[model samples]
Target: MAEFEAERRMPAEAEQVFAIVGDLDRLSEWMPTPIGVRQTGDGEVHADVDSRDVHADGLVGVRPEQLRLEWGSEDSPDYAGWLQVEHAEPGHSSVVMHLSFLGDQPEARRHGSAAGEVRQWLDDALAQLERVVAGTS
Candidate 1:
C-alpha cells in the first residue's frame, strides 16, 4: 500500500474548519475530484467521481467532536482516506488529509511520478479547501 498526507494551515478556528471539511455532501467544493455527492445512507454516499462517467459508492464517517472525517470507496477497496482538523495557533486551524492506495493499480500509477501527481492533487485540494473556509469558493 502507498500512503500520502498533506496539511495546511487555515485562517479559522478548528470548529469553523471542521464545519466545512466534515460536510460529506459538499465534497465537490474542495475535493477536486468528485463532482457531486449524494447521501445513500448513514455515513454512505454515491459520488460522481472525476472525469469518469462512473458513480462510486463511498463510506464517509464524520466525527464532529474530534473534528475528523474518514472516507473510503466501497466499490474499490484500493482507496481510503481521512481528513482531520485541529486547533493551531489562536485564530488558526490545521487541516491534514491522508490517503492510502491499497492493492494493485497500473504500473505508471505506482511510480515516483504518480506519487508527485498525487501530492499535487492533495495540495490543490487543500488550497481549494482554504478557499472554501474563507468563503471565497
Candidate 2:
C-alpha cells in the first residue's frame, strides 16, 4: 500500500481541536477533499467527488476517547484513512492525518509529479484546519 501523512501543531488543546475534527457535517469546511458530504435520514453517509461524478457511499467512525476519526469508502475499498489528535503541550495540540492507497496502482501514484500534488493537497488541508482551529476560517 502507498501511504501519506501530515502533522500540524495547533494553538488549542487536544479536545478543542478534536471537537472540530469530529464534526461530520462540517467536513468540507476544512478538509480539501471529499466535497458535499451528506448523511441520509437512514444514517448512510455519502460524498460526491464533484457535481458531475459518481457519489461514493462511505463509513465514518469517531472515537472521542482516542481523539481519532476513521473514514473509508464502502463502495470502493481501495482507500482508507484516519485523523488523530494528540496533546502536545499545555494548551496546545497536534493533529495528524494519514491516507493509504491500497489499490494495485499505489506505487505509481506515489511517485513523480503526482506525489508533489498529493503532498501539496495534504498541506493545504492542514492549513485550512489551522484556520478553523484558530476560529479564523
Go through the candidates in order and give each one's C-alpha lDDT. Answer: 0.81, 0.78
Q: Return the lDDT, model 2, position 118.
A: 57
In order of appearance, the predictions have TM-scores of 0.83, 0.83
For candidate 1, the per-residue lDDT at 64 reads: 98
Residue range 1-137, candidate 1, lDDT tens digits: 78889999998999988888777667778876535677788889887845446578999999999999999888998888899999999888999999888867531254676677677778988999998888832
On residues 1-137, what C-alpha lDDT tens digit does candidate 2 reach at each position? 67989999998999998898787777777866635777642335787756236488888888999999898888778878889999998888999998887886433277866566556767888888888989932
Off by over 4 Å in 1: 33-38, 51-55, 107-113
Model 2 lDDT vs. the true structure?
Answer: 0.78
Q: How does residue 66 of candidate 2 score in lDDT?
A: 99
